[model samples]
Target chain A: MGIPYFPGCTLHVKAKGLDDSTRATLAALGLELTELPEWTCCGTAFPLAQDNYMGMVASARILAKAAKEGDGRLVTVCSFCYNVLKRVNFALKNNDEARTKLNAYLEENYNGELRVLHPLELLRDDLGFDSLKTRVDRKLKGMKVACYYGCMLSRPAKEMEFGEPENPALMEEFVKAVGAEPVDFPYKTKCCGSYQVLNNYDLVAGRVKDILKAARVRDSEVIITSCPLCQFNLDWLQDRFADEDKSFSKIPVLYFTQLLGIALEISVAKLGLDNHYVDPKPLLQAG
Target chain B: MTSEEMTRKVKELSGQNPYLCMQCGLCSASCTGIGVMDLLPRQVMRFLQLGKEEILKNRSIWMCTTCLICTARCPRGIDIARVMEALRTINLRKGNDILAPEDVPAELLAEIPQMALTSGFRKLSA
Candidate 1:
């Protein structure tokens, strides 16, 4: 069956590897990702100001497209996009005044019937981890992986009802399903400083340092994440910090789908392992 | 505007009752930007409750990455991140943007992820 996929802005442009790997991984699992027609960005951030109906209009248009095109399920790879789309979906359903105002901006009124889903939710809830285990051809044995949730996928508990907001185990379950050991790290659901990387690199560097330290101390060989922003911050900041901090060790940050692609026996190039700032190829090949 | 007006505006914009905050400091305690923010999360809520209009002008609101750790951990179920974003919106709507897209160096813009650029513009731009 085909699912409506919204690659968002980041995945469509800068994070093609994540988009490619997500498509390949899902295709291997007997699910086809059909891109929604004429979908724009999910406004990147959820406009928290109740008065800003334009942001809701932008997100509502995307949901409208998903409702018109696919099976009323919009799958997103980027956590920021997922959060924005999901929150907007929640508001459009609950707030009548806001919904009426936002609907005025759209050609067809969205009745909040569309469901926004993350790739992790699709794998865990839809595909079932057990089913995924049965298809694993190349087991990631002896691989110590740290599953980073990075806020967006599991935060604002009311909206993102995927798992435990603070300490999600869905990725860990997926790792175990692929036959790899999931490391328990304290900073798994911690924020990676999100968009602060644009202006405040030092603050992000400090947070990334702590996140990586927690994983490394747990003896995790690599880090797996679902968010493009989290992957970019964790991977790119590691390179920036490596020059300043001599004790800093580089850990390969791969999308969870990339790791799943490896366990599914998909080619390394197809998973976009080469596109990562810190090369995951060595550790992935060694596994 | 007076402090009462500011508080009223915040409550209206965020649709969150700041009076519900019990001062448990869970929001402040869980905030990741505590080191950078001049006023912590709990303090930001306190400023809103006390109708301190100056809180809108504080740099603490902009420093927030909207990570929602505070909102997730709030004992009173207050959406502190939304409150913070409301403060930013008030500031931005008043023609006080933290950063302009034209001012950002092309070299730095090219290096950062597209998510950062897009979300930054949404949050920081007027």
Candidate 2:
């Protein structure tokens, strides 16, 4: 069965590698991801004002499109997209007043039929870890990976029901399924200062430094995450930080799908492994 | 606006009762943007509870990255992040935006990811 996939705006532009690697990894696991037709951005962030019916309308339009296409489940790789879409879906289903107002604003009656899912959830819950193990062509033996969940993937537990909000292990289990060692760290669920990378790079750089330091202290070889913002902050900011501090060490950040793509024996170039600012090829090859 | 009017507006806009906040510093402690904010997360809530409308002009609300750590850790189950968003909404609705698109250098704009631009504009722009 093909899962309806929503590749948000960023994946199409800055994080094309995530989209490519995700498609390749899912294909290896015998799961087909079909892009939803005419999908718009999931508003990136959920609007929180009580009277912002227009913000809810923006997300409602996307969900209505998914339902109109007859898709029961909508899967996305971006944590921002996952968080916004899931929260909007939860509201449309649980809050009758909000749903009525949103439906009226969008001029379409949506019954909140589409279910939002993260790609990690699909791999962990839908496809068994054993199934993933069977598909791994190259075991990532001795590779110490810090599975960074960032903030959105599992937070505001009531809305995001992926796993344990504070201490999630879905990524760790997925890493182990591909025959790699998962390193437990304190900042696994820490915020990477998110969009502050745009205007306040210094703040994000500081948070990134702390997250990387935690991973290094735990003896992690590389950092793995599912969010593009987290991946960009952790991977791209290291060089900028190293220029300011001589003692700063570099750690390659890889998207979980990219790591899975490597274990599935997909070629490096095919997975865009060389596209990272800090090259992960050396550490990946060492594994 | 009077303090009572500001309190009523915040309560209506956020749908979160500021008075429910017991002045616990958990939200401030968990907030990642504590170093940057002019007022702490708990302070923002306290100002709202005290009906201090001056918080509306504070830059602390804009500094929030909406990480939700404060909301997740709040003992009173107050969605502090949402309150921050509500404050931003109130500010933006006044026809004043925190960022101007043209002021951003084209080169920097070209290099940054779309997620950052989209989310930033959504939060900071009118």
Candidate 3:
């Protein structure tokens, strides 16, 4: 009846739309997302330094608690959190030294027994796409959607283990199940300039520019993504500098959950479609 | 750290061996940040192999988003992204913060997601 969910920091702050839509859509699917009690940030970006055992503590704390909770599995929507948590889980499971050091530091014994699931994996593995197609009342019949994986969903392929790191089909498969057409673009697995958005705004915008154009070229009305950062860069940067480029038209980028809410007949208001910088409401309504 | 120590430190920090690279240039080709990088990913590996520390000053290491595209494409099974992180860790641990939190404009920080700020500081700050 319930699944322990980790929304991470972004979902609580600026990316409420992703959180709201995820909760709303999952509720519609007959699953309750119970936020784990006393969950803190997953320490975004898995610390790469072997000596940075301190960096692993935050996520380790979360996983240790999730292990004792209702279901032994923990799910998070933030791409960074998913990658970090999953990588930490993988690291803790494989390396005895890391597990011993981290567990000693955290004062808990967690041998990476935690199962972290992204909603996409849940839909494919648990919900079953065939059943999802049958449950849809407001099927998104004619809309062409381009799903952007944008790095975190599947990368360092051995660790994340969700989909193909290159040319991932999970998001596209979800689109097809909802009766919408999924358009494949080259930049689907590409990085959206990530943390560099802070240091070089233009460089980050330039990357987003390419991503938007690639999706638009494929004739996708909107691009959907799982990462909040990816959604922010791809969606907001276009509106931030729209006037600067007269030749390029603005396109909407949205969280995949928002589209899921739509396909499942969750109200547009509840889906947080209006919160986006490049509004997909007009396109969704028209379609 | 000296040029000799840089290679050893990177191996110690990243747990990835740069010496295994065959100069395929696949990492550079696979990098999404190659557009802005002064030193290509392949060149970073080459510099490490040559025991050259000039890679520390290159803007490419900072520009790298650490998406791991190159790590996946490496024929030698090198975690090139970890190598990039190690290069950054060297500078950051020395208190050479590339992105100062104080310099970020108030408007953008107010608008940017908390994860962005957290990850930015984690990687860019000491």
Candidate 4:
């Protein structure tokens, strides 16, 4: 599958492992990821919620650049980027007033049809999951992981839907392909309270607590997720939440691709597992 | 608010069945961060139903994490998260100062660059 890779804001920084492991895994499957040089943020949840025009302009700006780079399809690691970019692009295509306004705002008339794809979508639709199954060097066995989709991947247009929205099988399939047992957890597509971290720490803390509590009760060794915000809320905030509630545990929250890379026997150091707030070693070793 | 207008508005906001809400408190009960909220998830829906634009514009909407727990727990299959997004849209447009102008608040901004340098989330939005 051919597409320019947009790791967005989070994967390059906090969830760098996701980008690294994804690139490696895709390479194993014979796919190339060309990151957009000087790509901007998707303008995240705020632009769309506040101003559709701004959201369209922000996404189109990125697409216009990608168009200039001569890549029509963009692959994103973050669910937020995938959702926002795709929705904005969809708006640009369907709404002439939107297109005109956004084009005017961007100072470039973008007629380019750019398809925003999630990395998992490319893996499943373009590369084929069966091929991924063949590349598994180490199968994660008996390790129950909660496949957290958060908000970005499956919502709006189901931009990267390889499975059900309420009950997803895409991430689960990948987990199983790597040999780990995907647990039936309640909070898979649930929000990590991604955008709320800025205003409501207490609420974010509660959401994290619930996610971890669900994982713990389900006997999950680790939690696997796709979005950077989800990773942040679920992983880094665990300690603070635990301190707040005493009962919360630092359940190693991992970027989903890291687990796949490890199971694929890809180098862990390069995967950036060390960067996570909750160390995944205990869970990885235990499994 | 007219019933038709309310229905259209809710559909525009959440893309779910507003009428589906059984008014069962499961959503509010299961809300992880309901205590910090001025109007709970269920209340958000009720306000939408009643066309309480002011309540929809309140700072509480911005406080929501868009955690679908409330929506998931809703007996009527009402998507409270989408409603939260709708309310967030309204709050943001009305310039309700929930957090700082930046998605990351000012107090957190000092640590953001350092955290970004080490953690990587800062670069995500940059």
Candidate 5:
């Protein structure tokens, strides 16, 4: 399958591992990712705020790029970028007023009509679980892990409308395909308060505690998430939450791809599993 | 002069669905962080419906965490989260802030070097 790849800013900066692992996984699955030339930030959590029009225009700009880049779906590894671009497309494609405004902006400044897709959506909906299951060689058995959906993946499910936002099991099913136990927890769709980390560390840490605690109770060896922000807050903030409440529990937060990379017998280092704040050595070794 | 006029702007932006919010307090009741909030989710929706731009601008909007419990439980499906996001967007437009104070959260930021070296989770920032 050919798809225009849009790696949001974080994937290149903070969550490079996600990009690397996703690339490897797609390649293993026989999917070709064609990079969009000179793609810009999707305006992210910023545009929709500062200027809905500008933010959307920014999103439309990327769409125009993909549409012109020939024939291929625009696939993204970053949830934020995916939502931003997809939401804009939804609005522009459905609302004439929005379409007029966006088209004008595109014609004058931009050039593509690329449809956006989250990597998982592509695999689950396009590739089918049966094919994915057959491709799995290393089964991650006995690995007790929780799936954290965070905010963007399924929220405002109507607006984002990827799947069942309330309680999505696709990622869990994928993890299960790899042979790991996907722990079910309450805070799956809860917020990690990624944007609030600075002004209120205490609050964010408290929220982090709640998420990790739920996973811990389930005996999840490490929490797995698709969002970079959620993974950062859950895995990185374990210590602070613990400090805030010395009785705070600690659990490594793992990326879905890292685990996939491992199951495929890929080098752990190449997967960036060792880059986590919490040492998952115990958990991975235990698995 | 009237409370209705105060929320006129919110009413316009949200398309007046919030006007039907019966004050059932279901939003506040279903909110995950109701007790922790200064105005609660219901109150925020009410304020937005009435066009209380300043209240919508409150950092509390950003506090929502985007959990859809309020929407999930609302009888009308008012989408309280969207109201909060709109406010957050407006606040951001005015340059009130960027990267939410906890962009990376302290504990998480501290783990950057370690997570980078150990997690096999590629660090794009170098």
Candidate 6:
């Protein structure tokens, strides 16, 4: 049986590599991700205002549709989708007034039973880290990867409830299972200026500079993240920051799934590993 | 809006009692966007408590990424991010959008993830 999956907009477009790698990684672990036949965007931002039911519509619809389809769980790849979907589910489950308004607006009886999950959480809970190690055909023995959690997967602990929300070890443990060294950095859970990147480029570049410096000083070879926004900011902005200052070192940012795909003996080309801005191929070969 | 009206409106929208803040400054100290915000998270909380309408005009409201670092670290358990969102809501509901879709560059539109565009629209628009 295939598990229902919701691939948000970015996964099908700019973050296709993450989507592809996630599918391959899960498949290698003996689970197939079945995409929802009719899924929409999770509105990206979970309306922070208590009354913004319009913002909750998209995510509530997703939760309702998934539950009505006879599945209590729906998994998505990107951290943005996971955050919105998860928070919306939490909000609807807790707030009776908002749930009623949203249900009436969408004209769907969403009981808020559907659970939202990211692939990392799924892998950890479903297949133990040791089980993951057993499936690794190729071990990343000499590689040192920095697991960048960023702000999405680690924020609003009362709402997101993902990982430690501070010193998340899920990605770190996953790195160990893949036979790689996990470098710890304080900036791992820091915000990368997120949506501000589209407007405040210099501000985001400054953030990227700090994150890269912290990780590099710790001797991390490659930085891995589950969010495409973080991957893009670190990967694309690092190149720009490096060009402006010769002393600035560039680091390749890879999706966690891409790293998992490598350990699963999936081809880099098939994972679209070459599509990164910093060119992760050299480090893969080095490891 | 009257001072009391503003206070009530924010309380209604955010569902957070701004007065719970002890002015410990942990929220401001831990804020990720402190470098860009005109008023720190703690200051925003204080302003919210005072029902100061001027807080709505500040850049601090726009700069908040809703990262919730402040919320996670607040000693008083005050959800500062929600307060910031309430201030943003007050401003945005006035039809004065912080970010217009046309203002976004084509280069960014082409390269950035759609999530960026969607979040920007959701947060910065009315």
Best by DockQ: 3
Residue-level lDDT of model 1, residues A193-286, one tens digit each, is: 8887776766787788899999999988899998888998899878777898888889999999999998998888788888888988787565
Pick the winner on lDDT between candidates 5 and 6: 6
What DockQ number belongs to candidate 3?
0.84
Candidate 2, after superposition: displacement of residue A108 in Å?
2.4
- Minimal lDDT window, size 10, model 3 chain A: A278-287
Task: For each candidate in the order shown, give its overall lDDT on alpha carbons.
Answer: 0.85, 0.85, 0.87, 0.68, 0.67, 0.85
- What would the TM-score be for candidate 6 when compared with the true structure? 0.97
TM-score of 3: 0.97
Taking the tens digit of each residue's C-alpha lDDT, what string does model 6 give over A1-287?
47889999999989999999999889888778888878988899888888888898999998888886645789887988999989889878998987899899989888678888888888988888889988885568878889899999977777777767777788898898888899878888988888987666666877888899999999888999989898888898777777788998788899999999988889877697877889888776754
Tens digit per residue, CA lDDT, model 4, A169-267: 788887887778888887777666665565566767777777788889988888888776778778877767767777666788888878877877777
lDDT comparison, 2 vs 3, better candidate: 3
List candidate 3 stretches off by more than 4 Å: none
Leading candidate by TM-score? 3
Clashing pairs in 4: A9-B124, A10-B124, A13-B120, A14-B120, A140-A179, A193-B65
Candidate 5 lDDT at A229 equals: 72
Q: Can you list each candidate's DockQ?
A: 0.75, 0.72, 0.84, 0.24, 0.21, 0.80
Model 6, docking class: high
Q: Write the per-residue lDDT of candidate 3 for residues A1-287, one digit (tens) a residue.
A: 38999999999878999999999988888778899999899999998888888899899899989998867888888899999999999888998988999999889999999899999888888889998999875557878888899988889888988768888788999998888899878889989999888988867988888888899898898899989899889887886577886777888888888888888878888888877888787766744
List the candidates' TM-scores in order. Answer: 0.96, 0.96, 0.97, 0.80, 0.84, 0.97
Model 4: DockQ vs. true structure: 0.24
Q: What is the lDDT of candidate 3?
A: 0.87
Q: Against the true structure, what is every candidate's RMSD?
A: 1.5, 1.5, 1.3, 5.1, 5.4, 1.4
Off by over 4 Å in 1: none
